[model samples]
Every structure is written in structure tokens, then in C-alpha cells.
Target: MSLPPPALRALQGLGAVWTAPNTLIGVLGGLAGMLAGARPYWSRRDCALVFREYPWGPGGAITLGNVILHTGASLEIPCRTYAHQAGHCTEPVIGLHDHERAHVYQYLVLGPFYLPVYLLCGGVSARNPFERAADLYALHGHGWWPLKKR
Candidate 1:
């Protein structure tokens, strides 16, 4: 059921175009982070640009589309300190890069609606379907999309 190579490439190209607005925002945010001493690096595994050691925000990491700004040395480290402090770290730690990459894919699918829909889904809360889906993908390497019930 997977798309053929040419079809997949076309679809991906369309997705990039569709998500360009959000990616622009991500680029702006990345630039700001860079000003704060964050170093940029391309992650082949995540297929996104990462700004490590970002000095602002509430801490940990934030994904603005194809960019991830994180307050850490590397994305391999666990970024969910709040989860651990709240005693909700029962599951294995999920890679921060992978979690943010899920958001990139979400942007590709949702395009201009991604930000509004993300806010409607409860922002950063654990109860948010977007966050849940990201965690699911990070933990299991699939299920990045939040499917609606029929």
C-alpha cells in the first residue's frame, strides 16, 4: 500500500511546499536560538535541523516544524525532566529528536492548520493527542499520526 518511488517523491515535495510557512517560522526561531549561542546541526535520523543548547523557553525542547530548539548537548539525552520529576517516567525514555521529528511530520500533513490544531488539542499537555502521538512514535517508531475515530 506504500506509494511508488516517484509518487512518494512528489508527495514529499508537495508536503514540503505545504509546510513551508511553518518551516519559515522554525527558521526564524532557529536564528533567534543561534543568537543565544545554540549550535545548529542537521540530524539525518530525524530529517530536521536541531539547535542545541538553546538558552530560552521553559527548558527541554520545542519543535516549530522542521526545526528543534533544545536545551541540551545532544538529542539522544532524555529531555523530559518534568515527566521524571512528576513520577511519570515509567516508560522507557524517548529520544527528544525523534519526538520533535514527529511534529515535523505533523506539520507536513496539517500544513497551515498545524498551529491552530495543536493549540486546540491542548498545546504541551500530556493529554494532547499530538503530544501523545509524538511520544508513541518516539517510543515505538510508528504511529506518528493521530487518527480520528470513525
Candidate 2:
């Protein structure tokens, strides 16, 4: 068989120069979202689920606290569904219970050690080992976890 493209091969590198910047930004945005959404009473099991279930996880869960400190604010989720179809509901659905629970979850997962690591190496490509792992988890949504037959 013919050889694979060089660009594709390079992408496998953790510190690959081409995709590092974008990956770094994604990591940052995820961390910021997590930090701004904290709650004290939330539990650890719940946090792990969020880190496991969502597209944003691992590093995203770790640096959340530091991002919260810099922003000096909280993450505001959309209270209403898109298209302004209905009034705001005070409670979230069960499947979505952990949807916006990033902040507290992040704190639980990494404790106080995540922020500095994020600051020092968040943008480095190799620092994102979990990115591929998370991607593998999400691939199930693309027909891997297809709906059941009636």
C-alpha cells in the first residue's frame, strides 16, 4: 500500500507544531467553562462522570479553577432552549444533570494541582494525552452508539 500523508503522520505527535495552537485554545476554553460553573456541595463521582462523558474532559477538567480566578466571573449557560421556544426551566433534565457541572467537577478531579500545570504546559501538544482518549470515547456517538430497534 502507498504511504500515508506526512501531515497526517505528524498529527500523531503530541507536540506537533501544526495543530498545537488550536488544541491549546480548546483546552483553555474548556477549563474556563468548567471553572466558572463550580458548586461546593457537588460530589466527586458526579465530577468524574462529567469528565468522562463530555467532549471536554481530562485537561479541561484540571485547569478549570485557574481560569475561574483570572476571569473573575462565572459561566452562564443558556437557560432557554434554542429558537426561544420555551420559558426558562429552573431544573435540568436527568441526562443533562452533569452537563453544566464542570467547575465543581474539575476541582474534584485535579484538586489544587491542575492550574499551574495548565499555565505552564496547557498549550504544549504533548500535554494533551487525554485528547485522543476523549475523542475515542465520543466516537461512539457517531453510530457506534446507535439507537435501539423497536
Candidate 3:
């Protein structure tokens, strides 16, 4: 896996630390994504340890805030049809790539705090400027979710 740019790395690191309060939760959420994604490679990678966060009861559902999966998000979602954050993400649909990629930049720019800001901004249903930009950044036609669509 190639690493992000130095500046982005630094920013994300800082965001992780600064937002440690919430990032702790995010870490747990992200861990879920990682685990599911690693399933096919776990034994091969010699991966050890099980990471799961059952917030409610023994039969409680997984809790993956912004971490979108193929089936759905961590919560009780019907069908999230969008690829999003953390370690693993479902493949992007026709219009969700640029939207989610812009969110990755938000993580770089704001780090952990992005989560709260996202929440305050209404999350998936948000109409905030940041969310708007991400949602519309590359709705036309795109490849990599860079500033300029390819």
C-alpha cells in the first residue's frame, strides 16, 4: 500500500492525536473494517487477535459510524450504496467516489475532529459546505478522486 503525501500524513497524524477523544471510538470502528477486509488474508498474514466492539448486547449489531461496507455501514442500515472511510470501504458506485475521497482529504485536513464536525454537520445527510463539496466534487465522471477528475 503506497503511503499518502508527507503533508497529508502529518496532518492525519495530528488529527488522529488531536481527536484522540473521538478517534478512540473511530479506531474501534476502523478496526472493524480492517478485520473484515483482512479475513481472506488473516491466516496467510499470520494475523493474530480479534477486534470487535459490541456496544449493546451479545447479539448487538456492529457499529461502524462512517465506515461503509459492501452490505452496509456499521449501524442498522438497509443498503448504504456508498463507499466510505477507515481501513476498508465498499467499492464506489457511480457517484460516490469523489464524495468519499473528498472526505479522505477532510480527514487529512482535520483529522479526528472531522468526525465530530461531520456529526455536527449532520453526517451522511449533511448539507454543510464541506459535505457538499465532497458530495459534488466529482459527480460528473471520474477515476481516482483527485482534485481533477480523470
Q: Rate the local accuracy (lDDT) of all candidates.
A: 0.79, 0.30, 0.40
Between candidates 2 and 3, the TM-score winner: 3
Whole-model lDDT for model 1 versus the true structure?
Answer: 0.79
Kindly list the per-residue Cα lDDT of model 3 for residues 58-116, writing each as its tens digit: 33122122232222222222223323432234534333333444454555456556667
After TM-score superposition, what is the CA distance of residue 112 in candidate 2 from its true location, in Å? 1.6
- Using all chains and alpha carbons, the TM-scores for the candidates as numbered come to 0.85, 0.23, 0.41
Q: Which stretches of candidate 2 lie over 4 Å from their true place?
A: 1-107, 124-127, 140-150
Candidate 1 minimal-lDDT segment of 10 residues: 77-86
Model 1, 53-101: lDDT tens per residue? 8888877788776778888888887655224435766677787877888
What is the model-wide C-alpha lDDT for candidate 3? 0.40
Task: Rank the candidate models, highest TM-score first.
Answer: 1, 3, 2
User: Candidate 3: deviation at residue 38, Å?
Assistant: 7.5
lDDT of 2 by residue, 1-150 (tens): 334878534433422233344335434564545565622222333322122222333322332421221122222222221112233233332212222233223233344543454345443232332222222223222211112221
- Top-scoring candidate (TM-score): 1
Off by over 4 Å in 1: 4-6, 79-89, 148-150
